[model samples]
Each structure stands twice: as structure tokens, then as C-alpha cells.
Target: MRPRGIFWPGVAGIASGALMLVALVVTYGNSPDYEGRNGLRETVEFYRDAGNRDLTEAMALVMLAAGLLFLFFLAALARVTASRSSLVLVGGILFVALTMIATIAGAIYAITASHTEAFVVTPGTGTVALLLLDVSYAGTVAAMVGAAVLLFAVWRASRTTGAVPQWLAWFGFVIAVLCLAGPFSAWLTVLLMALWTVLAGVVLVLRPPTEA
Candidate 1:
């Protein structure tokens, strides 16, 4: 396919990145940390409000949309890579899968918390909620592994075929490395990924590869 095919996907990637930032902001601004044991207590207390649940559900929906858009972005990159699309496909699939898992896990926690009557605070309720939250966070980190793989694929393709500029391709390498630190840096990985996707989108749209 011609590089022209990348235009819509590149646009979608930019939108995805914007939505990701929105989701990140909503999450941090509206929700409790939900990190440690104390965070669990905060989560329990915070979700007592119906408004919080509504906002969380909205954020989850936004994130789901972002995930799908990111997939479209990856598909465009894979199309450009042609025969080398396999690695991109693998990585994108894994990334989207984990994103789904993480979003669902968080949504379930928020949804469950909304129904105080249905979700009575048993002695184990807090622990279960905490586990769900942990799963969401850990799932995000695991998803970064897939993102790294996808980026590495992009970097290799760029190096071989000059699909993208050398500096931007190396920036992919930098973002991939930052992805590894997702576990330690809260939503820093999300921020970097968003920036990279936006930049990639602009590059793809403005400088269509001659060979792809």
C-alpha cells in the first residue's frame, strides 16, 4: 500500500494521544492513589460517592477508545513496514489486550464500589478491591512491554528502510526504555507514550516514506 494510507491512522494516533492525556488527567485528578495499604483505605472511602463512580466509568470509556485508536496507529505503522509487520502486529495485539484487561479491571472496581448495598464492605472487600486496583496498575506496566516491542520493531524498520527519520526512530528507542520504568513512575510512561504517538503521527503525515 502507498504511504498515503498512513494519513488517517496518523490522525487517529494524534487523537488517541490526546484522549490518553485526558484519561490520565481525569484519573489523577478525580481518583485516589490506590497504591499502598493506606491507598486502599483512601480508595474505599473515596468511592463512597456516586459522582466518583460516574466519573471513573467515563474515564474508563475514554481510555478504551484511546486503546482502540492506538491499535489503529499501530496498524498504520505495520502497513508501512510491509513484510516486517509481523513484529508490530504481535506487539500491538499484546498491547491492546493488556489495555483492555487493565481498563476492565479498573471499571469493575469502580462499578462494584458504586453499589454499596450490593458490594457490602466485608472484611475481605478492601483486599479484593486493592487486588483489582493492583491488577490495573500491573497490567499497564505489562502492556508497556508490548509497546517497547512495537517501538523496537519500528526502530529496526526505520534503520533498515529509513521509514522515519533517524532521530525520531532513536526517540522511539528512548520511549521504549522509558516504558520499562512504568512500574516506578506512576503515569510517566503514559505521558511519554502520548508524546511519542503525537510526534510520530505528525512525522508520518508530513513526511510520507517514499519506499513504504
Candidate 2:
């Protein structure tokens, strides 16, 4: 099997994660004193000023595209585990799709916070700045959940040597968990996820062929 739609969801996932890490750097550079900004208007200004809005927005879109690819990869992987049960396979696909939507939405909303704006940003009120942060928070959470479930689906695929590699499966699991804490250390999450993609590609290439 040529792995159907794409041969590199895991790789895509890792690359997208790296973009986010870069976005974080771009965002942090612009965010002056987060704690000191006590007004709603100021907060918005802070994020826009701290980040290269254009770069951050473009990166956000990239993250969304990568998330979508990851879901497709999960679907291809699930086929190896479903064992002829169309119901299980369909359900698995649904889960991946839902995760994709959630993650994309989150990345878009979250990344928008990092851009150039004329307003001053502060942490005081429920302003646009705060809202963007909240959206990002929710989005990251959704992406994390999706990754966890996708890992399980792929694990089932990895049950036999002909489908997925056991080590690669484990690697994804670790990366999924690390992504959850990306806000704390985007660089760390990006590194691990990058390793996951490379390992996944190697696994897919090495998987034993199944009877047609």
C-alpha cells in the first residue's frame, strides 16, 4: 500500500509544530511586560507589537494545513487496525476529522493574536486580546486531544508488523503529550514532534506489505 492520500502526515505534524514554535518566538519578542499590562486595549497592542503580525498569521495558516494533513495520516494508519470492520474504520476517521477542524480553528484564532495593531494591549479586561488568547487556549487543548486519540488509532494499526512500527507509535504518543505543554516551551514540543515525523516516515517506508 502506498499509504493512500499522503505518505507524510507525521512529518507534516512535526513541521507544523515547528512553525508554532517560531511563532511563539515572534510573539514573545513583541510581548513587553505581560503582567504589567493591566488594561484591555494595552493587551491587544502588546501582542501585535510583540509579534510580526504578518509572519505570525502566515504561520498560523501553515499550522492549520499541517493539522489537516495529520488527520489524513491518522485515517490511513487506522485502516491497518480496523480489521475489515467498516464501522470501526469510519468511526476512527470521524475522530480524526473532528480533531482536524478543532485544531485548525484553534491555530487560526490563537495566531491572530500575534500581529501589528495600533491599540495598546493589557491583561485587564475581556477584550479582543484576551479573547484571542482564550481561543488559542481552547484550540491547543483540542489539538492535544485529537493527537491522543489519533495515537490510539495508529497504535491499533501498529499491532502487527505489517502496518505500523511499534517504536514509531510510541514516539507519536510522547510527542502528543509534549504538544500539550507547548505553551510552556514551544521549542521543546517542536523538537520532539520533528523527531516523531522523521521516525514515522522511516516506519511507513519499512512497513511490511499486506495482501491486496
Q: Could you say which candidate leads in lDDT? A: 1
What candidate 1 gets wrong by more than 4 Å, as runs, is: 115-117, 121-124, 208-212
Residues 99-193 of candidate 1 have per-residue lDDT tens digits of 77987887786676665567864435766777887888888888888878888888998889877778877987887888877788536776777
Of candidate 2, the 10-residue stretch with the lowest lDDT total is: 116-125
**Predicted candidate 1, C-alpha RMSD:** 2.6
Best by TM-score: 1
Model 2, which residues run further than 4 Å from truth? Answer: 1-42, 47-51, 83-126, 160-162, 175-195, 206-212
lDDT of 1 at 148: 84
TM-score per candidate, in order?
0.88, 0.58
**Taking the tens digit of each residue's C-alpha lDDT, what string does model 2 give over 42-140?**
555544453444554555565556555555444545555555325334533453454345434433433534432433334442255455555554544
What local distance difference test score does each model get? Answer: 0.79, 0.49
